[model samples]
Target: MISGIGNIYADEALWRARLHGTRPTETLRRAEVAAILDGAREVMTQALGEGGTSFDALYVNVNGESGYFDRALYVYGREGLPCARCGSPIRREEFMNRSSFSCPRCQPVPRRARP
Candidate 1:
């Protein structure tokens, strides 16, 4: 969800992509993300300009039923499974009935040194 300057929504990309096709290209998706971030930044600027407190925050609802989380998981998931872009396998895992997918070639998971 996104909110700022009296504007709020559960899904910014879903809203922006309404004008275009629901299935947007990666470039278009990136643009939509940028627009949302920019809008929030603009809200902060507006607040600062008015001498009000300006701040930014991020929030996620794991239990949200609006499909936002599912959409994100679908896009970022499918790991080890063939990538739609490069034909790589999309990988996935199940935890408490929740699933996660990602492509190692596209999104390599960072390794942490063992203590």
Candidate 2:
């Protein structure tokens, strides 16, 4: 089953799935979609396993507790850091009024989608 995820989860899932932010859903094969879903599940599973997650001190849980899951992140909020799978630095861009992060080398934009 697929559920909607926020920007943070979407970024993490895309990074895990090695999918470009500008990638068109229509161009994705079944396996790629599966990978993205799996990535999302993995993130949620890990967060649930740890009770919850907080990106910063301001992101406390309903119980007012901070979780360590933020440290396990692969791309979210990690701009300019080396990608886990590739040595390329993760880049951040303004997307839909929010930040989107990805490794340039790992998730290259399709030529048609490039500005």
Candidate 3:
């Protein structure tokens, strides 16, 4: 399940790869999976370079500093905002007790059930 991935990075990577979170792994081509992994790596590398994502005061660095990467995010926590790739608004869905964000135009809902 895509729930194994954290909500924040998952949304960002999905947007980068133009994939829907509910996409079944069995339905994905090897190249698509690779691209998604690459997207995740790229975003994570960028996040690490900028410290990390800190949503609140409780999540602070060793120096008690909040990360600045939140401002650089494209999809996560950007509900109702325009997508960078498509002009569609980013939509948030409740999943596994948390939220999942995606561009409805870019990442369409899957019609087939996951294997």
Candidate 4:
């Protein structure tokens, strides 16, 4: 298990890894988990370099400056938009009173067994 990952980074990393957000963690292969962690590190590094993501004026750094990483995001908060890696549309779903964004083509949801 990992730590220090917020919702935005998690979604962005999942998108980069091409893994569905709703997939069971126990079903993930070692390589897949590695890829997810790698994606997370890559995006987090980029976000840190840019001072992090800020969608509104409420989020400001010690200097009272907003982050610019939000513009560079691939899927976070980009519902119904074209995926950066593909022409397919990005999808958003309501999760625990929050939103999760991903590329439907890149990250296909796994079928669940019927009760």
Please give the CA lDDT of all the candidate structures: 0.38, 0.74, 0.76, 0.76
Candidate 3, 8-52: lDDT as tens digits: 778888889889988888898888898889888877777677755
Error of 4 at 88 (Å): 1.0
Off by over 4 Å in 2: 1-3, 53-67, 113-115
TM-score of predicted model 1? 0.30
Model 3 lDDT, residue 112, Cα? 88
TM-score of each: 0.30, 0.80, 0.80, 0.79
- Candidate 1 ranges beyond 4 A from true positions: 1-81, 95-97, 113-115
After TM-score superposition, the amount by which residue 24's alpha carbon in candidate 1 deviates from its true location, in angstroms, is 28
lDDT by residue for model 4 (1-115), tens: 3334677778889998998877777778899999899999887777666755442322343234444544667998788889999978899988656788889999999777334
lDDT of 2 by residue, 24-53 (tens): 776788999999999988877776667554
Better of 1 and 2 by TM-score: 2
For each predicted model, how many residue pairs clash, with residues at least 3 apart or on different chains?
Answer: 18, 0, 0, 0
Give residue 30's lDDT in candidate 4 (0 to 100). Answer: 95
